[model samples]
Target: MRTPPNEAVATDTVDEGAGPERTCVLSRVVRPKDALVRLALGPDGQVAPDVRARAPGRGAWIGVDRRTVDEANAKGRLKGALSRAFKTQALEIPSDLGERIETALRQHALDRLGLEARGGMLVNGAERVEAAARQGKVHLLIHAADAGADGRRKLDQAWRVGGGGPAGLEFPEPRTILSMALGRENVVHIALTDAAAARRVLSAIARWRAFIDPDAGLDGGDAAGPDAGEQIRHEGNA
Candidate 1:
C-alpha cells in the first residue's frame, strides 16, 4: 500500500526536542509516537507491528490496549481504519496480531535491558542490588516476577531507606528471561544506577506491560505513592 505523502498517516521520524506526535487511527487521540504502537504495511500486503517505529514507509498508530485492538480486529473496525489510513483494502492483518504485538513489545523491553546492562548502567544479583539500594546509588529497582516475596520486601525497604521508593517494579517475565536478557546467572533483581538509563528502560517496559493490561500494577507492593518507574505513566502517556 503506497500512501501519498500528504496522507494522514504518521511517519517514522522522531523530532529531537519535544518528540514527534502521532494520532491513533482508531481512537483519534494525539499522543507521543513512543507512547503508541506502530503498524507498518509491508511490501507483501502484510500488516506487521513496527514496535520501534523505524519501519520504512507510512504507518498507523494505535493507543488502545491489546484487548481493545483484538476486539476491534474481530469486529472489522481495525481493518476499516487501516484501509482508510493506507488507502488500500488489500492489506492482510493476522488473526493473532495482538499476540504478535505483545511479543514484539516484550522483546523490545528485554532488548532495552540488555543494552543498559552492556553499558554498565545496571547491577544484578541480590547482594549487589541491595548494597547499592542502601547507598542511594540506585536510580531504579526491579524484581523478577517470580522473585521471593521476602526478598522483594527486603530490597524494597533498602531502596526506601536510600531515598528510592516504596517498592521496585516487577518485571513481567520470570528470572530465567531476565537472566538471559542481562547475560547473568539466576538473576532475581536489578538496580540501575544511572537516571537516564533507568528512564529509558522503564519507558520501554511501561509500554509493554501497559498494553497487556492497562489496569495492572507494575510493582508488587502497596502502590500508595509514585515510584521512579511509575513516573513514566504520567509523562505524556495516553
Candidate 2:
C-alpha cells in the first residue's frame, strides 16, 4: 500500500517551514518534497542527485534509504522507475548513483552548517557551547564524530541542564571536516541558538544520516524526539 506523503509543517525542530509535496518514484509514496532527495535529469539525459532541490526542470524523488537505492539500481528497478518518472527511456543512470547521492547529501549538510555559522547562528568551542547550553539558549547541538567521549558527556549533560535536549547530533566526519566546513579550528562541538537555523541544520543532518545509517539512534538512544533529537531520526524514515 502506498502511503500519502505526510504534510510538512513549521516547527521549532522538525522543519523550518512548509513546502511543496512530491512523489517518490520507487515507492510511489507521496511526501514533502523537502523530505525526499531529488534527482535531476541533465541536458544529456544523465541523472544526478539534486540534494538541495535547486535544479530546474523535471526531476524524480526517492524516499528510500541508500542500500535500497543501490539494490534497486543494481537490479534495474531504479532505471525503470526513472524512466517512468521522466516519461522516457533515453536517460542514463550512473552506476555510482548511490555514491553520488550520499556524497551530495553529505556536502549539503556541511554547506548548511557553514552557512549557519557564517550567519552567526551557531557557536563553537566547548566552553562557548557549554555556556550557551547551560543558559538554555541552544536550539541544536552537534559534535564531531571523533569528539572525545568524556567531552561529549559533559556537553550533553550541560545541554540537558540548559533545556537544549537529550544530546547533540554526531557529525559523520571528524573534527578536521567540521573545522573546514565552519572555517574554524578544531571544531569539536557546536550549538545553534536560532530556531530556524536549528531546523535547517537538523533537516540536512537528518536526511544525510538517514540515508547513511537508518537504524542508528540519535545520540545512541532507542528512539528519537525533537527535544531529544527525534527530528533527525524521523526526517528520512520514508
Candidate 3:
C-alpha cells in the first residue's frame, strides 16, 4: 500500500507521515497511528488492499474488516476517502472488493507468519513464551495471523495485564502480524513486528492487539476451566 517518498500511502500506514493526516471510512474520525490498512487500485481499475503497498499508481486506504469497507463503498465514503487521499477522478469499487481485499490480506498474513515460523521467529505455546520472556530472550509477542476473537483477547491481556500496569509494558507484536494489518483463517502466531520484513503486520495486526480485551479471559460470569472430560477444539467448541 505504498507509493513512493511523498507518495500517499505505500508502507502499511505505520510511518510517521501517516499520523494525524488520516481518517477512518467507518468512523469518519481521524485517529492516530492505530491499526489501518492501505489499498490501491489495480491496473484493471478494481481495488485491492495493497498488503505490501507495492502496487502501482496512487493509493487508496480502507479500514480493516468487510463491513467498514462496504459501508464506505455504500455511503461513497470509500470513494470519498480515496478521492480525498489521492485528489483524483472517481474510482470504481466493486461490491466484492471487501471479500477480495480480505482474501488478499489473509493470504499475506498466512504466508508471512508461515515464513516467520520457518525462520525461527515463532515459538508457540504459552509456557514456551513465558520461558523465553523469563530468559530475557523474547524479543516480541506475535499472535497468530489467523487468531480468532477468543484467542486474540487472551493474548492481548497477557500483554498489558503485566505484573504492575500497562505503563512501559511490552506487547509482543510480530512485524508480519503488525498493528493488525494482515489476517487469515485458522492461523495465530507472532513475530518481530518492528522488523523491516515484518513491517507489514505492525500497522495492520498490531493495533488489534490493543483494542481487544486483554486476557480474553472468558465469557461466563461463572465458570472455571469448563466441565471435566470435555475436550476443547480437539473435541468441540465450548
Candidate 3 residue-wise lDDT, 80-145, digit = tens: 667667666556778777777666655554555555555665455555644443333333445433
Candidate 1, position 132, lDDT: 88
Off by over 4 Å in 2: 1-18, 220-238
Minimal lDDT window, size 10, model 2: 1-10
Q: Give the total clashing residue pairs for model 3.
A: 35
Off by over 4 Å in 3: 1-35, 63-65, 80-90, 125-127, 142-203, 207-238
Report the lDDT tens digits of candidate 1 across residue range 1-238: 0012211111111222236778898899887777789999999999999988888997999988899999999999999999998899999999999999999999999999998899999999889999988887887788899999899999988887777766787888999999999998998999988766776777777678768977765553336243222234212221
lDDT of model 1 at residue 100?
97
Please provide, for model 2 over 10-80, each residue's C-alpha lDDT reduced to its tens digit, 9 standing for 90 to 100: 22223323466788899887767777899999989999999877889999999888999999999999999
Question: What TM-scores do the predictions have?
Answer: 0.87, 0.87, 0.50
Q: State the displacement of the C-alpha of residue 179, model 2, in Å, after optimal TM-score superposition.
A: 0.4
The per-candidate count of clashes, in order, stands at 0, 3, 35
Q: Give the distance in Å from residue 74's predicted Cα in candidate 2 to where it truly belongs.
A: 1.0
RMSD of each predicted structure: 9.2, 6.2, 12.8
